[model samples]
Target: MSNLLWLVPVLPFAGFLILALAGKHVSRVWVAIIGAGSVSLSAIIVLMIGIGFLLHPPATGNYSQTLWTWMQVAGFNPKITLFLDALSLVFVFVITFIGALIHIYSVSFMTGDKDYSRFFACMNLFVFSMLLLVLADNLLLLYLGWEGVGLCSYLLIGFWYESEVNGYAARKAFIITRIGDTAMAIGLFVIFYQFGTLAIPDILAKAPVLWQQGASIATITALLLLAGGVGKSAQLPLQTWLPDAMAGPSPVSALIHAATMVTAGVYLIARMHVIFQLSPIAQMIIAVIGAATLFIAGFSALTQYDIKRVLAYSTISQIGYMFLALGVGAWTAAIFHFMIHAFFKALLFLAAGAVIEALHHEHNMFKMGGLKNKLPVIFWTFLIGSASLAALPLISAGFYSKDQILWYAWASEGGNPWLWFIALLGAFITAVYTTRMMIVVFWGEAKTEIGHHPGKLMTVPLIILAFFSLFAGFIELPHNFGHFRLFSDLLHHVLPETVLKAGMDAELQFQLLALLSTFGGIYLAYVFYYKQPQRIEKLRQSGFVMNLYLFWFSGWGFDKLYNVLFVRPVVFIANINKNDVVDKLYQGVTFVTIRLYRSLSFTQSGSLRWYVMGLVIGAIIILSIQIML
Candidate 1:
């Protein structure tokens, strides 16, 4: 069973190659089977492997398979190896499992499209890349997976290539993520330089002994790695691209924004936590970045009109909580939240897809009202996802996972009142926007007629994910409940222990505070959006309120700021030198050649006498030049 770990990533790659080669020739039904079947098969094998590992733990507590010696030099060698441990196991299962579900959903969601085969091909390839990322044994292999997913994103996000905006969105996602990828690549170089190895275990083992806590090298490495995570996960500064990434198919949104790529950063940080733990300054900055991004993204979610864009910002905000958990040394909590988040967020995106299809592709929540009956399945599934996202008390998975982070934010050894206050405020904002989106989309009067209802293929994935969203948290309830931390216990072998342990008194206090903030935000949302809708509308039109509204709607002008700061300057320079300065030498040669050709053309006046005279003159000039030489 352990030997089969190599097959997990290979299956998806095989599917990708098959689809890429045969998609245009294959029937659409066959395309769906080859696409969805490939991933589904991988899921089954991963389940078998996971069950086997759990039942018969390996002596080393991990399994590694070296497929080949990838490269070797005098002192440098990197191999094509796949590693399976508690950490990679969690990510692999989520990716293959949730990813398989999303691929299934996409088949029906994309029905009647001309590019169905292309869409599924891109999706299978995306899963293949992510599997490589988690299973990679070395930093070099990890980087390959990192860039592979980025390439797949560019391909899938622009799948509808006829649309110029979709192309723009795809490029934006690729370029922004590349900034972090570049940083991560440099961090890998730093690791090899300092530790003389690219293997994760080797680097982690050497980091603590080679560099003291808060050493400059440690800080630099930690920050560089964080840059990669921040960009991939859609954290602050690199986050603008995600909202626009809604330009892709809804299933693409679910896969990238939910189960896979966005979470890569959190996984990267978690995987390399030892280096981060060596630098308190780097760790503190992680907490601060998470705090700021959660607030910024939460407020942005409030102003979104597009249904997918709202979820996009929400995705960013949710990942911020994971970063906060990582920063606070709640390693188990961060990963636990990531799992539960995958369940709910994927559910939310898929359900949103069903609603959009039902309404003939309408996107504005303002325009979509009272879908409770029209889209009963979608509404209910989305409600489950929403409640989890809002961190509603007890019943949903979001409550347990989010509550863990909230408690750790205030109770961990790294805790400060300020970080807690900001996180709590962000939670409140999360609730407000989530409730607002639900009310606007599902609770009001019906604003439009329903079109095609979702087929079972679409609703089936939603039902499965909804089940996870509703109950997955029970596996990891907060510690105050007396050891319902099955989720954390399972991950304990891989993660480090946290210094923060709450006494009964402190746990009870934080729990109460979190509950108030949770319900308080919900209560306020009802008062503002549901109960007194006109008052909220009036506030939106108010002078200063409108300014803030526009700001949030424009993503706080980050795109515009970047345009002025980066994009425009580059564009301006290019325009001034529209014909590149480097090309001028060629251009000058081209000018002389054109002049000589024109002069020679005039001499060839369709007469043998002119041709003969020109040849004689050219011969005379060649002889004169040779004599001079």
Candidate 2:
């Protein structure tokens, strides 16, 4: 099984290469099968191995396979190795499972498109890169996969290269994430310099020794890595690109925003839990950033009319909650939330795709009322997804994961009650926006004509994800109810358990807090959107509130700020250098040289007498100088 682990990423990459190189000549059906089939096969293998590993666990609790020596230098060798442990197994299952579903959905969603082959090629490549990211045993190999996924994101986001906005959106996602990638690369270098290796397990093993020697070194390294995570996860200041990422096809949006790329940051921090354990300050920063991002993105999501953009902002916010969990030392809880979040979020986005397809690409909720009967499959799937996202009690997978995170936030070592308060507020906001979106899009009278119903291919994935969204939470039920802590225990081998455990009484307090937050959010959404939709209209009419809403709607004006601070200034400087500096200096030098040569050329005159005199004069001068020497 370990030996075969390499095939999980290899098969998809091979499919991508074959389809990409020969797709133009191949039939579209073959291309679809090759593209989707490659990932599906990998998913099947992963399921088999994953189940076997889970049932008959390894004694050492890890399985490693080194494919080959990727690079070797003096005392530095980074092998292309695949590792399957509790952590990597979870991510691999999600990447392959949700990834395969997205691939299947793309087949019907993208049928008859001219560049269908190219789209599938990029999708397969994305799965390959994402799999490598999770499976790699060393930081160098992980970075290779990291950059590979980013490249695929840029490719797939702008899959329809003919649209200038699509190309622009792709560039935005690439450049913004690159900022974090650069920071992360530097952090990796810092780790190597301090620890003298790039192997992840080795680094984690040695982190405690380094921390005990000099705690500041560990803090700097951890913070730098967090910076990288922030960028990749679309947290806080680096979150503007995600909303605009909707320019891609719906399946691409579902994959990038929901399943794979955006979650890389959370995975990174969780992967380096050892380093993070040493830096309390860094952890606090992570928590605070996560809280801030949740509030900002939640509020921003409330204002979005574009269906995909709303879901995009919601992703940022939900991932922020996961970061908050990680920051608060609830590593198991964070990953638990990540697993459940993947199912519901992907379902929501895919369901949104179905809605758009039915409404002839209409995305605004205002234009999408009363779709319940018109698209029954989409409505039921979306309801299950929305219920999970809203964290409805007992029924929602999000209820289990999110409740645990909030509980940990209030009870963990160094936990602050205020952070929990803010998180609760964010949760309410999440419910409100999600409810408003659903009501406006599916509950009211039909505002647009429904063109066509979605095919079984699309709805099947939605139905499967919906089931998970509803019931996946039972894997981590609270202690008061018999304490089925399967998820936390399964993940303990990989994640660090905090020394300070919350008291039993504190558990009840945490539950009350979570219930209030969840119900408050639902109530606000019902009151504002369902009971009194006119209030939203009135709020929209207010000048101040309208401007505030607009600002949030535009991603807190980060795009404008980037344009002014970076883009315009760089363009202006380039223009000035091109016209005033380089042209003037270079052309001026050329003009002087030309004029000097012309003036000097008059001495030649092209005459035999002049040539003879010039030669004699030159020889006399040379002889005079030689005589003086």
Candidate 3:
């Protein structure tokens, strides 16, 4: 089973190769099978190996398989190896399993599309890249997988090449994420230079001996890695691209947001927990960024009218919770939320896809009304996902995962009151936007007629995901409740246990406050959007409120701010240098070469005497040069 680990990523890569080679010639049915079946097979392998890992833990508490050496230079040898442990196993399971489901859903969702095979090819490649990312035993290999997903994102997001807007969105995602990728690359170089290795186990083992707590070197490397994570995960300042990324197909969004690309950063932080632990400054920065991002993205979600755009912002906000947990040393809690988030966020995106398809490609929630009755499957599944996103008390899985973060944000040794308050406020805003989305899209009068209903192909994945969104929390419950520790206990081998700064006496009080925020946000959304719509309209009419609404809707004007700060200046310089010194230098070389060619052409006049004379002149010149030398 351990040796077979290579098959996990290979299956998807093989699928991608097949589809890319013969896709145009194959029928759509075969395309679907080749695409979805490959990932499905990978999922089965992961599940079997996962069970083996649990039933019979390895002697080292991890399984590593080295296929071959990747490169060897200057005594730096990194192998093409896969490392499987409790942590990477968790991510691999999600990437393969949830990824398989998304591919299956894409089968039906992409029917009749001209580029059906192309879409599946990019998807399989995307999954392969992500699997490699989580499975890599070394940072260099990990970075390869990281860039693979970035390239695949640009390909899939702008899949419908006919759409200019989609192209812009794809470029935006690629270029912005590249900023973080650059930082991560530099971080990796520093790690290798300092530790003389990029292997995960080696780095973790060596970090403490090499750098003291809060050392400048440790802090610098950690901050650089965090910048990379922030960009890839769509955190503040680098977050503006995600909302526009909704321009891609919904299944693509699910893959990127839920199970793969966006979560790569969270996995990075968790995977290299020792580095962050050694740098308290970097850790605190993570918490502040996470808290601020969640709050900001929640407001953006609130202002979105596009259904997918709302979920896009919701993803940014949810990942913020994961970051918050990581910053507070709640490693298990962060990964736990990541798992639960995968379930519900994928459900939401797929369900939203169904709605969009049924409504003749309408994206605006205002145009979508009374869908609960029209599309019961999507409505029910979407409602479950929404409830989970809102963390609706004890019923939804989100309550367990999110509440854990809330507790740790206040109770952990690294946590502070201010972090807790910001997180709590973000939770409330999350609920408000979620409720607003549900009402505007699923309730109210029917504004658009349904064109079609989702088949079992599409609905089954939603049903499966919705079940997880509802029940996955049972594996890890609160102490005052069942105190189930199955999830956290499994992660104990790889991640350190979170230490509490306070006793459990205030747990219930904190839980109650979080519940109040959730319920209050829901009730407020009901009042403003559902019950008295006039109130929302009137509030929007107010000058200040309207200004705020526009600001949030514009994603806090980050795009405009960036344009002024970066894009405009660069464009201006580019325009001024349209034909600058470098161009003239090249043009002069071209002019001289053309003149020489013309001068040389006079001797080639189809005359044998002229040709012989030219050869004689060339020989004379060569003989004179040799004699002089």
Candidate 4:
């Protein structure tokens, strides 16, 4: 069963190839099966292997399968290998299983589209790439998967290529992430140069022995990797692409932006935890970046009227929490939150998709109202997701995971007072924006009629995801509550043990603080958006608040900043070089050659004698040059 791990990623790629080649010729019904069925089969295989892992675990708690020799040279060998352990298993199950669910939802979401086959093709390929990323045994293979997801993102985000705006958004995502990918590629080269191996386990084992704590080399490598993660996960500065990515289909938003692809960065740092642990500086930077991103994105989420854009900012903020956990040495807490985030965020996006489709692509939350009665399924399911996202007390999975990260941010060895405050504030912002989104989109007066209801295919996935969003955290309950840390304990072999600097009493205190923050934010949102809607209108009319709103609404102007600092300069240089100065020398030579030929044209004035004389002169000139040499 373990040896068949290769099938997990292979199934999705096979699905992609089939759909990509013949999907257009076939009916939409078959396209749906080929797209969704492929991922469903992959999920089944992963479940079987996951069961095997539980029943008969490997000696090292990891199993590696080398499919074939991929490439080999002197002192270099990288294989087409797949690894299965608690860590990769978690990621694979999430990618295939949750991914399968999203794919299923997309079938109904994209039923009538002309580009349905193309959309599914990109979607299937994305799952394949993500599976490869998690299952990879070596850095090279992982990078292939990493870049593969990036390409798939561009294709899917711009799936409706007829739209010029979508094309720009897709290009923006590609170019921004490519910056970090370049850095990661360099890091890969450095790792190969320093350690003489690209295998993940080998690198982990060798890095500590070869490099000291706080080593510059290790710090550099860690930072480079963090850059890649930051870009992929939609962290600070690099996050501008995600909201714009909402230009794509809602299923694309749900699958790539919410669930699988956005979490790729978290997986990278966790997979290479040794490097981060060795460089305290690198870890500190990770925490700080996470802290800053959450705040920026949190505030940004507050001002968004676009339903999908609000969730996009919320996704960025949530990933910041994951980053903060990684920085504070709560590695398992980070991944635990990542898993939970996937469930709820995907649910929210899908629900939002249904709402948008029902409204004929209306995205503004302010323009949408009183959907609770009209679209009861979407309203209820979206509420569950939003409640989980807001960390609404002990009932939601988010409270369990987020509370751990906040407590750890304050209580871990690497934690500081400031980190905790920032996270707490971000949590407040998360709750506020989530409540605001739900109130505006679901509650209040009706702004439009619902033309259609989401079919069973869409609603079923939401119900399944909503169940997970509410209860998945039970798998990793805090020690203060009881001994239900099954999620972390399962991955104990892969992750280092986490300790709270402040013990159980402090744990309860942080939990209280988290609870308070969640309620405070929710209360504020309810008061502002729900109970007294006119107050929101009045506040919007104020010059100061409106200015503040506009600032945050523009994603803190990062896009404009990048455009001025990077994009505009590049475009300017490209324009200036459109007719390159370097070409002048060649142009001058052509001009002179033309003139010389014209001057010599008189020599062709009609005669065998003139031709013979010209031939004789050419031969003499060649003879003279040879004699001189």
Rate residue 118 of model 1 by lDDT. Answer: 82
Which candidate wins on TM-score?
Answer: 1
Task: Write down the lDDT that model 1 would get.
Answer: 0.90
TM-score of each: 0.97, 0.93, 0.95, 0.94
Write down the lDDT that model 2 would get. 0.89
Best by lDDT: 3
* lDDT for each residue of candidate 2 in 413-477, tens digit (9 for 90 to 100): 84688888888888888888888888889998999999988898899999999999999999989
Task: Order the candidate numbers by TM-score, best to worst.
Answer: 1, 3, 4, 2
lDDT, each prediction:
0.90, 0.89, 0.94, 0.91
User: What TM-score does candidate 4 reach?
Assistant: 0.94
State model 4's lDDT. 0.91
Give residue 414's error in model 2 in angstroms: 3.1
Q: Model 1, 310-410: lDDT tens per residue?
A: 99999999899999989988899899999999999999999988888888799998889989988888989999999999998889999998887888888
The parts of candidate 2 lying over 4 Å away from their true place are 499-501, 580-629
What digit string (tens of lDDT, one per residue) describes model 3 on residues 428-471?
99999999999999899999999988899999999999999999
Candidate 2 TM-score, C-alpha based: 0.93
Error of 4 at 512 (Å): 0.9
